[model samples]
Target: MGTAGLKALLHRVRYEVLPAKSTEDKVLAHVPRDVVVTVTASPVKGLEPTLDLTARLAAHGYRVVPHVPARLLRDDRHLKEVAGRLREAGVDDVFVPAGDADPPAGGFEGALPVLRRLSELGSPFARVGVTGYPESHPLIHDDVTIQAMWDKRAYATYIVSNLCFDPRVLGEWLARIRRRDVALPVHVGVAGPVQRTKLLAMATRIGVGESTRFLAKHPAWFARFAAPGGYAPERLLTRTQEALTAPSAGVAGLHVFTFNQIAETERWRRALLDRLGG
Candidate 1:
């Protein structure tokens, strides 16, 4: 892709934020209204925080997508209420992941069920998103994750890849999905400008069960973030520019995992856009 195409991608990107006490203020203060803000559903806090933030952001006239993890919900009635609430709040998009909740809060164990339920409920949301694992899921086999997407293809409108640092892994995963005919437009997930200390602190609060298992699976996470001058998001983007922007890739846009570093993330995005001449 040329710089123009890359610039357009950077200009229209989604910022994923964890639901925290001061997150709303930071988002209102730093993020542009045109950019989509997604609220994450924390296993510890459950779905209320995610819904609340989504409603607040939507009220402010920002397009917001809330993470509705299947494991966090209780049942179909609860899903209907949640859908009704989102509709009333004016949200049109949602991201559904299997989630980190252990033993689940109810019968919903994976995203497919909730996704199917959403469709059964007349597909209330305009855009429904499912998780994509470019890297191997810590617990689930690689084939299983790919198969999960195929299973979810009927219900989900798009796929948001999880955080990944390697371009090769992302390319290979994208290839596999395309081969299997899972053609949903992908919003590639990348980490935003993050400070090592804050990243570590926030990881703990996301959910103990998932965090612990995830840390064990990717032991080098700390070292990568702790490296000299910290992790540079641009380097990854630069390397994957062509693949991501290719017509055949079916990439929708970028999904930045801000990790609640909203202000820093906004700053980094602006600076990167400037460098890209966006």
Candidate 2:
């Protein structure tokens, strides 16, 4: 990384997880002490587990940002309880995304309702993150997604872009966000150096529809990865560097989707950073 690039990487790094059994220890063991680590709330495991994991991670001195999926919350009462738990745990940051639950859990179907409630309760968090889709979501339209982001900006401190393989798409999206004057700093999402076979196997065991939706958005990437010689994350990171170098780019940092390949991911990150003199 260049001098500016190194500074950006240091400031923007974040690790993600699904709050699986033993994930807390796994995350703590492999993730770098300096990077902000985020535990995600999956539909299967629910938010409580992730919240508890966040508290434990916070106690251990890591800056933990847990995902608060909107659909998982039952109502305002539940939201207040969740916020209180986080505040007591010294967690001052959260990532709010419209969850993937089939039926609406309560009155809130999307992030705006939950975000509004959090704001109303006088949330103690210093940073509240909202999701951004650089690629098209399977269900929601692009216009609705953009408008939802705009609507939630008042309650959000930052925007974490959903996974996108093409850096050019990210660059264009950043330009559009700036053009629209949506100034919240962006944390670009990238998957770590995971083997193609491993990724595919994991995806199958998880859910094929979800995996298909992901692959649909990045056909070129899937095709490339499925080809001979397999895939490497360096291609993605190199493109990321190019995108971040653009003048006045609001790219704040990186949110790496480690997919529980924590050790290898960190190793790849360190090696790349060293190569860039970071």
Which lDDT tens digits does candidate 1 get at residues 159-261?
A: 9998788888888888889999999999998888788887677555535333233544686765688677757999988888878888888888899888778
TM-score of each: 0.95, 0.90
Reference-based TM-score, model 2: 0.90
lDDT of 1 at 257: 82
lDDT of each: 0.85, 0.77
> Model 1, stretches more than 4 Å misplaced?
206-217
Q: At residue 190, what lDDT does model 2 achieve?
A: 77
What residue runs in model 2 are displaced by over 4 Å at the alpha carbon?
1-3, 207-230
